[model samples]
Target: METAVADRKDTLDVEDLAELCRALGHPARVRILEFLKKMDKCICGTIVDSLPLAQSTVSQHLKQLKSAGLVKGEIEGPRTCYCLDRERLDQFKQYVANL
Candidate 1:
């Protein structure tokens, strides 16, 4: 049936969803996402200040999130401003619901 085929197509799209999951596998990354969700955008130093992590650790987590397309970063002068990619976050939620 067409419905079954469509379901198959969605299943085939799991690779990206899996990458998202891996990015979120760490507790620190999840917390980073939650923090970003609350703010419009913030620099890496602000994120470091909010968490117990060192700046470099926080930067690494942000990098992973950005790589997974769950976060977006824009360079502003000396800092990189970070925020949740709401569309991708929604897509991740949809993927989980489908599973």
Candidate 2:
């Protein structure tokens, strides 16, 4: 579900923040974010290699992050390179700070 926040450079609204929190609710998803932060960029196989979860499970977590706009993916040849959306994450932090 796209939101006005997705198109704007401003902060996320109440609903968007709630959705982002839910997307980050899972521990596995948190771990995936941490792993991605350390890498310059990563592919699905690399993420699966770093985590204990199965490839499919990791993919699900990635999907959640991507959908939430926390991460961005670009297809490169046979794999998709994933990276943290640092600006959006910083915006999330600011939103949480005000709360």
Candidate 3:
């Protein structure tokens, strides 16, 4: 017999979903994601300027998002450029939709 969509464990990685959810738990993170979505790539300072949060706080949020695989960052000279990991974001969306 076929299992229901919600009961199919193979449909999505629960742990990954949980991590992504946690990464997006904060409003700052969500706004950062939205900003990254609009721009092809941005530096840490640019993101900090866009939000009212301090540079260190924004960095922390970026770190959490990066750890969750939702964002990608590359070291460029003295700054780090960031962009959304579209593939991972899409996967997370799919996982949520599957639930």
The per-model lDDT (C-alpha) reads 0.92, 0.85, 0.93
The digit string of per-residue lDDT tens for model 1 on 47-89 reads: 9999998889999999999999999999999989999999999
Stronger candidate by lDDT (1 vs 3):
3
Q: On residues 1-99, what C-alpha lDDT tens digit does candidate 3 reach at each position?
A: 357765576645877788899999999999999999999799999999999988999999999999999999999999999999999999999988988
Q: Can you list the residue pairs that collide in candidate 2? A: none
Which numbered prediction scores highest in lDDT against the true structure?
3
Predicted structure 2, TM vs. truth = 0.83
TM-scores for the candidates = 0.87, 0.83, 0.88
TM-score attained by model 3: 0.88
Q: Which ten residues in a row have the lowest lDDT in candidate 2?
A: 3-12
| lDDT ranking of the models | 3, 1, 2
* Model 2 per-residue lDDT tens digits across residues 8-96: 63443777778789888999888888888899588888999988998888888999999999999999999999999998888788778
Report the Cα lDDT for candidate 2: 0.85
